[model samples]
Target: MNWDDLRVFLAVARAEGLSGAAKTLRLDPATAGRRIARLERSLGAVLFAKSPQGYALTEAGQRLLPRAEAAEAALAEGRAETAGAGGERLSGTLRIGAPDGCANYLLPQVCAQIGAAHPDLDIQILALPRVVNLSRREADLAITVSPPATQRLRAEKLSDYHLSLAASRDWLAAHGAPDGPEALKGARMIGYIPDMIFDAELDYLAGFGVTRVPLASNAVSVQLNLARAGAGLAIVHDFALPAAPDLVRVLPDRVRLTRAFWLVSHAGPRDARLDRFATLLRDGMRAEIARLEASVA
Candidate 1:
């Protein structure tokens, strides 16, 4: 089997669609589709079931997955070994999945430093509202508020981040800042949509007495932006405070919450590049956390 064709197959299997796989592999949809078709023909098997929802792997494809992944891992090990032999810095894409808040507030700077140190490395930061599945190879590493429960994954505490009630100066002046959570009743509150919150850790408003969120979005940045726009008060992460200096902390001492960031990766033989990259992430996160906490202080 052609390794290049198998690579395309692996991308399609993971993405579950030609277009998504194409985009990820930086190939046009036509090229990706053609490659898959060629691979299927060479193997004499239908690899995927086509449907409106997306591509679903056939039994043949499922059977081929583990072997493909093993080959990929071996290739990665070879690359790492080659780089080490040359006494060169690690090179390749390091994909990180993180919440929108962390991605927006913390990762850009961290990624910049990582990029500067390893000019050949490409860092792909997926800063989205939904969790990235490391098991599916969606990300090489993930920064999550909660650790994964799966035994196949290894997690380490990255840092503790603080969240507190905040509102814009204009909103506080017009509506008066709440003395505590109780006063938030009937207050214009910006938060995650009640039912759409992807992670339990994101259900921040549940701790408060208020059940309804008048203004809501799944994205943390959207909630913070709305708060800055004087729409309402929000439980904002301290790291984001630098972006909206006009946002006044409301009852910082009384209404405060802390969440731990965990660095998660799949369990397996350690890759030199991943280990070095993880170190960079840990140091960067620690520095950023200190900077953010100091800003609030």
Candidate 2:
């Protein structure tokens, strides 16, 4: 039997009728019925019983489901692989998903390099709240602080960073920067929630040779917003805070902490554009981190 016939039968079986199958596959009722009829004839067995309600799978149809499903899966995979194989010029669209901070600090340079090297390529840099699954092809490339343990994917460390006790320039000016540990008690503290990895920055709080005024641990992203709005002092990842025109580092010596960045992508299909894109990102980010480190020093 033809794959189309089996596919129509499977859809009809699942959808419960030719009408539903046609709706699902964007086909007409007559077309779906014709294909199903052809498949049953080719198999020399009645695959379905049409009742007033819809199509119900017959014993023969039940037997054929597994084989038909396997064949459909194989065909889909073959089509994806064939479509994925393309030249090394990086002419197609590339989607890179990253956290807000990375998008702010690193993306511009990466975009510039990619644009210059591959003028025909369309680079879409999406700043998302969650990491998309590279294994499932949710994104072409992902930059994250966490990496998954999967053989189907490849990952690499991009750079390391510590947290910074930061606040807006207005907040620091009005509050008067506290220089010593004793002055921190009751200090308005902006913080990331305890579950986040950057919560390590909280370790350096008032008790660790420091005391803050009214300390609180909030989520990092939220804390950044609060800090920017001059709400309180947040221990932000050094890489997370873009150089804000209104914000400034406060109590830098009070919070000493560090973390790493990782780049992740799929290993299969070996998308040449993604490979070149990741290499470019690593190189650019490393240089930017070095410059920031020097400035921090």
Candidate 3:
């Protein structure tokens, strides 16, 4: 229950014997034994079964060992990030993943800025729609809309952005723009193929009466390209829409859609580098959204 008890338990579990644990803990062998006994007594469990070679942890001690070590590790991280530890330079690899739109927009900017600020830190970026697996260490940080439920991971809502359907003026002139969701029933839609990254966007659009006419390009870039060329309407995030001048918004009133992107990381001491990068991203995105609204206005 006490920190000392846990520390003593960890010392013995790691050291393999009371004598070795005593040396590690800077205490006498009998004192180490006494502490272990008291720890076991407090919990009403046997900590170790003695042998000629060393002490072997009982099932209970084996179970307790990992938890105690994790607690210690977490505690150390907490101390490192505390008030007195100001300007603790982060020098470690931080793996991160986010959706492709982010990669296209601000992923590089954020990474470059953070990398410049913290010269010793290395960053790896993976951009995809599917949530990265924190349990498998696929990423140390993630930006996604996925709900966070992993045991040792943390997640928070990062920011929100809007989705828009765009089509070239000529495309609209030929096919005529849909006045309502029902009108979309006959219009050609540039849908992502079944297994592509933006398939979920197509699924969302299907509810709006926009049936899939499947464009030849399976990639989002190609879909946007075709949309710009007056091929068909493509659903795209507001962040990536402005680059194409020819593409105009299609039935904004009928398109009832908004999505929140979340930022996730392994739960522990607050990562200052990640924290700084998140603030930069959040502010930049807010500015971008405001600019988008102003342009529409």
- Number of the top candidate by TM-score? 1
Model 2, residue 78: distance off in Å is 39
1 versus 3: better TM-score goes to: 1
Whole-model lDDT values for every prediction: 0.83, 0.67, 0.68
Candidate 1, lDDT over the whole model? 0.83
Best by lDDT: 1
- Worst lDDT run of 10 residues, candidate 1, spans 76-85
- Backbone clash total for model 1 is 0
When superposed on Cα atoms, how far off is each prediction in RMSD? 16.3, 19.4, 16.9
Q: Arrange candidates by lDDT, highest first: which order?
A: 1, 3, 2
RMSD value for candidate 2: 19.4
Q: Please estimate how well model 2 matches the true structure, expressed as its whole-model Cα lDDT.
A: 0.67
Instruction: Please give each candidate's TM-score.
Output: 0.70, 0.56, 0.60
How well does candidate 3 score on lDDT at residue 128? 67
* Candidate 2 lDDT over residue span 40-159, tens digit each: 778899999889988888999889965775565455434333332553456778888877667766677657655665678788887765566776677788888765567787666565
- Backbone clashes in model 3, listed as residue pairs: none
